[model samples]
Target chain A: MVNLTLIIALPLLMAFTMPIFKMLNSKLPKFIALLTTAFNLIVLSSNFTEIMAAPLILELGGWQAPFAINLYVGPLALVAAFLINGSAFILSIYNLSQDYQFDDKFYLLFLMITAGASGMVMTGDLFNLFVFIEITSIAAYSLTTFAGGSSYEASFKYLIIGGVGSVFLLLGIGFTYSAVGSLNLAEIAASAGLINPLLLQITALLFLIGIGIEAELFPLNFWVPDIYTEAPTAVSGIMSGAVSAAGIYALARIFFTLFPAQQFFNYLLVIGVITLIMGELIAYQQENIKRMLAYSSLAQMGLIVTVISLGTEAAVKAGLFQLINHSILKVLLFISAGVLISAAGSKKIKDLAGLGTKKPTAAFGFTIAAMGILGVPFLNGFISKFMIISSSLNADQFLITFLILAAALIEIAYYLKVVQKLYFEDLEIEVKNTAVITVPVILLTLLIIGLGVYPQLIAEPLEKAAAEILNNSRYIMTVLGGI
Target chain B: MLNFLEEWSFFGGSILLIFIGLYGVLSRKNMIKILISLGLMDTGVNLLLVALGYVEAANAPIINSVNPSNAAAFVDPIPQALVLTSIVIGTAVLALGLALVMKIYDKYSTLNISEIRGLKW
Candidate 1:
């Protein structure tokens, strides 16, 4: 009977109190962030079995569901929270080796972003979701500026886009509240059938646009390359690995649970496909390693969105699996890429040529992550990619299947280009003293290989999560029955 | 007709404000103006949220002796509460955006976003 709220509260409490800790000792914030993320993981794991058995609904302020803001941690949310906190935990370790100007503020924002995302995944109220989204976006907006050169420009662009997106989100929430007379998601889902059809469509469209921006879908993701390219490596890693996961979770919850309309799913399907193809095509052209990885991550988000939008249990399961894989692989890629970029003294792929011998740990980390993403066998990405294809084929989506494979081909082309350069090409520049990230790289590699070898290790959780997402009525019933 | 005007005016005005802000964001090159427009959009959304809870001839949500026992007479309070929270968040974002704009100005020596071509697709 561990209180689940502490997963969010502890990080936020620690984040806000970070400056005080810094005043006490300048070195305390990083350890505080590390401790908070670790504690969050422990809290989440303690509640995992119970939540999987039955979605844990915690009503706040002694009020019942439909009357108060509650937190519903179903298997889907639990898995997403795990990914968010797990990425944060790993990145906090990554942070220990790196120093930044105003390191205290950095960890503070980092911890807040982690807390905000965890809140986004766990909350059962729409307004609470909006608040969490704002918190995460604000922290992200500040976090991006840490790189200090063109990062200001990137942060501004992201701010404008994110600001507009939040307006739409608020409008959507307003519409939903006006129609349903309740902000609690479970209550709204229970009564959503009664909303006027046209209004429902409008609300759904508003939410799609709003959440779509955060999820980095097609036509609304121009800010992705810049922010990911300009932000510091750990910031970029968390943005890709944790924040975007939460964004997709919110989108899925909105579309699948709140408004299960086929038309919306069709829209998501089309958007996802376009995002996938466009991202890979653009990623293929980037000489900057971080920007290429950024586009590739964008494409992965699109792939996950398309699969989940298929609105089948198997499709959702495959999507979630791919999501898990993407988070793990992308964090490793960013971390190693961070190391490689520093060692090569440039962001250009050419400058990083033949550093494999000098920076073997980083190069190996990057190569394995890339190979995993390219769907080489006996890697985590291979399992997810196989599952995605099989599920899409079972659903008889030939065009989608074809497009996905085509994207994978482009992915392989660019990734192999990097790998070939890493091991085969001559060194173009003298290597700098790069931080040794042996521990995080080894840990992530083990997870990737271990998952690939025995996919069943996470099969139960993935299946249950997919089931939880697909069955929104059960969500409504569970939350409402808690009253 | 008056009732319709009252209702549609709030929705129409807010939507119009949002469109104006969006146009400013897309059309203006000056960064400060764009942030102002963003503020306007946020204000518009907040207004719309508050309007959503409006009830004709309704009292405030407070339970004073004058209007006590008329629970239904008060406008829906949730949207107002939400708007309060949103207003605070909007201000924070605006403040953050302004700070970023200041830093950008310091770096590029210009406020025009088009001139600051450090990043492009």
Candidate 2:
């Protein structure tokens, strides 16, 4: 019996004791981060089969579900945890090669963010979710300032927005507690039908405004591009790939389980579509490569949210698949682009011209990931894209389908522009010795192609997770009934 | 009237504090003031949470020699626990924000947030 609590606890324990490790050996924190994430992945996989068979609910302090905090590792949560830990693991590998000024603090924050994100996914309590969200956000705010210049401003912007959003989230929690007299997610879901309509509406809106900021929904995502652009590459990779996945999981849990209402789904649909179009359009105009990728990441987030908001099992599965693909592909893109940026000593897309020959591995990484995102055949993204299209069509949402396709076209144009600059254009700047990130690149690439070729590899878990997310009664019964 | 004061006053005052903090957050130009406003907002939310768990004529949720067995007379303790956690989280965030604001001050040599447009939002 692998205790799932270790997934969060080990990282947090390591993170706080990181300075002690640093005191003992100057070279210990990065490897510690890597080992922690690797162990987390191992722990998650060890419990995978059992959790797939039945969701594991761990009651803290020997108290029952309604009265105590619990960790619910449903199929959906298990998949999300895998994605979160998987990203942290890959980024830890990337971090091993790079050094920061206060690297011990960096690794500390890094581990905490991973722990916080995993906690967000597995937690069965709403207040616990808020705590995890705050943990992730605080770590992120500190992590962004590592770049040391404009990064402070970026971090400040993110801090202000995140602070306000958290306040709203607390208000929502208060409303939920006042109404339901409980904070357990399953308990709330079971009696959620009894919440007064007006208070429900207000609480839902407060939650939307709160979680939407973290989930990168439209209008609430203004702080995203700057933070992604200014933060170190590994930080950007984890934030885009891991933390946002947790955000979406929280959103899905709230809207689907705690308050499954047609009205909220409609609100999400509109917000997701708007976020998608806005992200793509803004990405089209970015001059900086990281900022471009940031906007593209935002668009991908919007795309995932839209697909899942369709409320069909197939659509949810497709959304989750796209989410998995986006995490893998974006991490690859950011790492490769980070290399390219350092090699060129500039962030402009034009300056990166003709690096294809100078930096073959990184160029190849960027190209393959870009192509994967653009939905080229035989890549993981292609299957998810196909699923999204077909699922939306099945839902008979023609206008949404058109908007999504249009966003894809915009995505293809910008990504191809960067790729063309990499290979086809003349060399505009001399290259420097870039970090050797070949290992992570190669690993992510293989996974992308492997999943692309064998789409059925994750078919069962994705289907089960989709069904688990859609059925609130199953969640309520599993958590409360198990008591 | 006393019942109204007990119920509406706590709720209304905290909500008003939240709005006032929000207004300060939006209307203030200085970065420190903005952070202070954020603190106010956090306090307001904390207050509101405590108020939500408030029960009329109830005591603090403590077990003493005299009130050892009476659980129903006690106000809810969950929100108070939540408020404590929230306060800690809020303090950490505020401190981090203030540290960043100091760094921004060092770089831009000004306290005005509008002037620190190194990266345009």
Candidate 3:
């Protein structure tokens, strides 16, 4: 089998290749991108078990161990890769033949964004992670602004705040490197307990702040609603679904691997609770459909963070299961929201009145998504939430269980607002939009429904993933060799 | 004496500069000025990287005639290498941010963030 390094590097290769292919004709770019991503998705999925079980490390250029920049794939990496590549494939198909033209350059940047994201999920080195993050950041910045006008304004705001975050991240990387004398994540984890406490403390705080913005955590997440509402829907899908997961994964990885700390979890718990309360409360106030989903996404991530910080088998697995479900449900919600908005000719929630009558199938997909998010029975969100509540309850966290169930109600309220507008409100203008469910969006909707019905399809793999994360020494031993 | 004082002054000045950047981002009206202050904060980070890696009476990391084992006395090269990458990435971000500021300016006509509070909650 080809090394897993190819999984992270293919998009970079295609980024360069797309420009060259443009010399022949612009038509070649989209297929080439599809081919590269398809190949990556297949490769990543096929090796899913090997990476999950064995602490697989793929060294770049045949260099060995901590000396080489390595791609370390454990269960977390595999699950992230699965979500990223799988969703990218679906989103690409959905975006194709939409109003926007997929020029050679656009496809090239798109593939590069995918590659950079996958690389972040796979790599085990701090320096390389920074490089890949920049690749993704630049691609995201330019991609969002491709619509021009206010998109540029929103993108600028993202860039300024994002730049500040980047500086903090780089500063953290420098401090950590100076302390550990190596860039390898496994090595850092091995040496973490012994590093200078002051330096490690500084580095950890810096990274927490830096990556928090990208993850859309509170106190630094002021940019999300604006950026989400402003970006094109496909970009919005990628931002909320794939990129947010990447940022959270980075935060989780560094906290778990680079610097394991009880204090960090304490911080995560407090911040996550605040974000959950604020996000749902704010989502309740939004008029725009996309903006509301953005707030909902923030709240869901807040819940994930809360459970992830618990650092238990059940809690971690519940978090992962929810993460997977959230991504699937979100894309379904976002794409259908886009379709509904397009049909109704305005993005304002009130303007979409009677859209249910106009596009019944799309309306039905959105309804299922709403139900899934609300943790209704038999759906995937319910299983994950049940796991979270059961695990928390078992752990004697009665307060957590109470808040989680309360948050579920808030989720229901906000989602029902949109549902009511679509089904109950009057449609002054009959949207002539046909019930044309595009192939990729349809597939994505089905995946959401399917996963909700049978969460074991994802939870089993996530459990394996969660087990790997807790077994930190396996990662430490694999890359640094019994240190 | 004055030259030595000037040299040592950069130490406190760098810290002050970072504080200033923070203050600007926290309190400024003009978005562009806030972005400039962000660049200054990056300067502080880069400076910190450089200062930590500096060795008092040392040569550069490159060596040919010198004994290899004695290289410990030289400035730590890794942080410098790391910071060089940071500086380039910072420049790229600055350029991108400036482009965005120009766009924001073109649309809103006013650079004051308070004036462009149209998207706020």
Top model number, lDDT: 2
> For model 2 chain A, where is the 10-residue window of minimal lDDT?
A426-435
Q: Write the per-residue lDDT of candidate 3 for residues A336-431, one digit (tens) a residue.
A: 897898788788999988888778877877888888888888777788888889888877878877888888888888899899998999878858
Model 2 per-residue lDDT tens digits across residues A115-145: 9999999999999999999999999999998
What is the lDDT ranking, best to worst? 2, 1, 3
Evaluate all candidate structures by whole-model CA lDDT and list the values in order.
0.92, 0.92, 0.80
CA lDDT, candidate 1, residue A481 = 89
TM-score of each: 0.98, 0.99, 0.94
The numbered model that scores best in DockQ is 1
DockQ (C-alpha) of model 1? 0.82
Give model 1's share of reference contacts.
0.92
In every candidate, how many clashes are there?
0, 0, 1
Candidate 1, residue B57: lDDT: 89
Summarize candidate 1's per-residue lDDT along B5-114 as a digit string, tens digits. Answer: 99999989998998899888888889899999999999999999899899998989988788768655888888888989999999999999999988888888889877
